[model samples]
Target: MSKSAVSPMMQQYLGIKAQHTDKLVFYRMGDFYELFLDDAVEAAKLLDITLTTRGQMDGVPIKMAGVPFHAAEQYLARLVKLGKSVAICEQVGEVGAGKGPVERKVVRIVTPGTLTDSALLEDKETNRIVAVSPDKNTSVWRGHRCKAANSKPS
Candidate 1:
């Protein structure tokens, strides 16, 4: 089998991946959300899909698999509902075809609420994404934080 390789941009993403290792990472690569090494294997098992491998990382073989960007939100929702966290790695710079190295970065990390896709979101319910920094000082709360204060105690 041909070993898929990770670009320089992807290498940078691996750094972010280390932070959220327990989470199913959607490392954005070009038009697809790529998973590398163990991440690919785990996602494939959880999603009941195919498992493949990509080039090498630190001189070690790397496995990989991915879903298209358009359908990513749907897949993400499924993983989330199953209590799996995801880290979205996005390309920051404008790197087109044959433009040498593509500048990429982990633009936004989506957990639950931060999702903007209508298909993955519920129309009648509210979705929220919360983030807590390591310092325990910078906590970002996304979406509505409102709770029903006066409910019929049933």
Candidate 2:
């Protein structure tokens, strides 16, 4: 895509996405968290969801896919099980509140090692977020609840 053809919203997403390269970014827009480009393609294939185009950039259609926020827990559970991490980007303000695109930011990074929602966990299962000792003889697991999914605390 040509640099000139990118929309402000897409640019905003790219900016937040740059910070977390290894994780899938679940960018929240309206009632759903949308995925674009490779993120959309990968997720659509994995989740068997429809892959569609939202807009065009440089005359090429921009690929997009999304799951409703209400159904996100199931998708999150599936992705976590597949060993893919997710970064949630939430809208931070009312539309047009800013001079440009709607304000949004990465709110949370979800990984298999850091899961606390019982809905996402299977019965009789456990998850441990760990750090290994320099000698490799010891490991530390952090067992705590996840932060509220927000880039800025309310």
Candidate 3:
């Protein structure tokens, strides 16, 4: 079968996966975060998790692996520690009328280079990724040192 013949779910996954090609996408499906395609293959080996086939698409088994959503933070920490990034995609809305799939969106991306969640940060004040200019006055700091995302610097 061709790409067009693939399942709607797979199509949705592919669309979102395209946005974060360099990061593994943790696609939220109920209690589990599913990994598909190369993410599945790579994560399974790296995380030492079971790699299994959930279903078939285009006459091929759609490779997949997943971890319980409740334990996702641990997995995310492990992956990030290994210098891997992860895109957290969650169902955003109801399926709506007709045959539409549940809406989903990438809520956040976690990378080894940056960490904001206090649970993931040890020395909250020092560990950071910043762009420092030769001028002592001009410094752009990231991580928790940054201003609120929804506010303007005053």
Q: How many residue pairs clash in each candidate?
A: 3, 0, 0
Candidates 1 and 3 compared by TM-score, better number: 3
At residue 3, give the lDDT of candidate 1: 22
Please, what is the TM-score per model?
0.65, 0.80, 0.79
The CA lDDT at 78 in model 3 is 86
TM-score winner between 1 and 2, please give it: 2
Better of 2 and 3 by TM-score: 2
Please estimate how well model 3 matches the true structure, expressed as its whole-model Cα lDDT: 0.82
Off by over 4 Å in 3: 95-98, 122-126, 133-154
Q: lDDT (CA) for every model shown? A: 0.68, 0.82, 0.82
In model 1, what is the error at residue 119, expressed in angstroms?
A: 3.7
lDDT (tens digit, per residue) of candidate 3 on 83-111: 89999999887756457678899999998
Judge candidate 1 against the unseen true structure and give its global Cα lDDT, from 0 to 1.
0.68
Candidate 1: pairs in clash: 4-55, 113-128, 113-129
